[model samples]
Target: MADPAALSPLAELARRNDPDRFLCALFAPPAQREVLFLLIAFNHELARARQAASNSMTALIRLQWWRDAVEEAATSAAPRRHEVATPLAAALREGRLDAATLQGMIDAREVEMEEDIPSLPALLAYLRGSAGGFAVAAGRTLGAGPEHLAGLQALGAAFGMAALLRGIPAQAMQGRSLLPADLLAERNLTPSDAARDPRQPGTAEVVRQLAGEGQRLLAEGRARAKGLPRAALAAALPARLAARDLARLASTANDPAQPPPPRGLGDRVAVIWGGLVGRG
Candidate 1:
């Protein structure tokens, strides 16, 4: 068992590092939580390392270190200066994780060191690599059923996009825009308008529309994920909550006490276990 205090770094760093991500990690088991944190930390560390040393060669060197660290994580022996590998290696020994998803995550981050996504398709793909990876890692820990796992992936994708959407204003403030150029062009909006702090009035409508679409997808994810076993509860609840939240945000207004849920955790557990196992 991991010391509660030891897991604090994982939890605290996850909270400050990325709240959207930290929420996802919370759905995962503590034993496996470290893997999610290490993946984010590795990406963050690599990004910082690249920025510290200016020039293409320096960035490559740092990325190569990450690559080697990934390779070393596959072996019984550790490599030189492998910070992320420590947790990864422990995960490997305990049969808690593997290398494919983790390596894919590092590779995605390396590609992001210089490139900027300008379209929704590209942004969606990148978001998948970021939060999707975390979802899969957590799913592995929970051993969720396929239906639930699919739902988790979809919900994770939505959460990832939400994070990107939240960062849009910040990016525009820095003179960079991640809004899909096509979306902007089709809507007849300019970067200057989007760059406006809190955005212009019309921007609110656009945000609402995007969130509305996200809510629809989240709805689909939850509907498909309702039949998983009790073991999957830890991960499934968070995804369900996320789906419902995006749905609420997309809607005009909502009652806080009892939000609408097609089939929520409490109800699902009641239907599945209550009738079958609990006679009273």
Candidate 2:
């Protein structure tokens, strides 16, 4: 087993940077929660690589480092001695994780280093590659079988879309836009228009359309939940918050250009209740 002290930095990383996942981890099995935290922390590192990099090439280099780290963890008798890699290697040694899927998640962030705007199909594909892959890995760690992988991926995609929608303002600030090009074209808007200011006229419509698609996927994924193992439900907990957040974004009062309001007390209760009832 990995030392508890060695896992603290990963835990703190999750708590400070991804509170929704942090809260969800609280309900995971005690033995497995640390592994989940490690996985989520690794994801945060990959997702933020571009933002942290000095340039696009620098971001690609950072991603390559992680890719190599995961490859080593999978094949080496003794993995690299790094915070993220150490726990990840432990998970791999125990056969609780897959290196290929984790590598796929890392590879998917390649889009983040580019300035191109993806179409709706491309955007969904990217979500499946990153978030969907993460869900499947989390499910495996919880002892879910192959039968549950599809459902977990669907849940993850829904969660991913909602997350991308929530990130519009931040992405816009960086001059990046994840909104589908076709969707923007339909609104007679360009990627530059949305990237310059998400609050641009007709931008809300595009956001609403995307949020609707996210809600649809959320419903589809929830329908598949009945077939998933109860333990696997822990990996889907973020869907609870995603659902609430999409609803808020679709509302008239909410501004797409601003960060979504922080999760409230009621939101936390709902997330816990959903986790207990195996709803998300």
Candidate 3:
């Protein structure tokens, strides 16, 4: 068994930096929860690579390092020295993970590091690669079989799209845009306009459209929930929050420039309830 003490840093990282996933992990089997936290913490590190680096090249270099680390951990008996890498190696060694899917998640971050906005198809592909890939890996970790992979991927894409919509304000503030360029063009809008003022004409429509798409995807995933492996349910728990937030975003009449408020106590309760019912 791995040292519990050595895994503490990863647990703390997930709790502090990715509370949504941290909460979702609480619903997982106790023995598997730590590994889930380790996985999510690794994701957080990858997702923040751009902001943490000095430039795009630096970000690429950082991502490459993680890519190499994951590959090494997948094939080697010895563990890496870093905090995230160590537990991650242990998880991989257990033989429950798909290293290719995890590698795809890392590669997806490359799109985020670029200034150019992708088309809608390209954007969805990126989400499917990063978020969808994460979902598949998490489901696998939860003992889901090969048959459950498609459902997990759909669930992950739904959650990812909702997350992207939720992040618009913050991404805009950083002068980054995740909204598809074609959609923006259709609205006679530009990425700069969104960055400068998200409340401008047609922006709400763009948000509404994306949120609606997310909700649709969420519903589609939920339709297949009953067929998912029982253990996989906990890994999908965050979908409840994603559904709630997407609905809220779709209906908000206030400035879209503002970040959505944090999930409140009632929202948390709903998430737990949804998880318990296997509806998420």
Winner on lDDT (1 vs 2): 2
lDDT of each: 0.54, 0.81, 0.80
Candidate 1 residues lying further than 4 Å off, grouped into runs, are 1-8, 19-64, 80-83, 110-116, 145-147, 190-198, 201-206, 234-241, 244-280
Using all chains and alpha carbons, the TM-scores for the candidates as numbered come to 0.68, 0.92, 0.93
Q: What lDDT does model 3 reach?
A: 0.80
Which segments of model 2 are wrong by more than 4 Å? 1-7
lDDT of 3 by residue, 7-90 (tens): 577787888888887888777887888888888988998988998887999999999988988888757457778888887877
Clashing pairs in 1: none
Report the C-alpha lDDT of model 2 over 178-274, residue by residue, as the tens digit: 7887889988888888889888757888888878888887877777655677776788888888888889877777678998777799789888898
Minimal lDDT window, size 10, model 3: 1-10
Cα lDDT tens digits, model 1, 66-114, are 6777677667675454455566567656666656766665565554454
Off by over 4 Å in 3: 1-7, 252-254
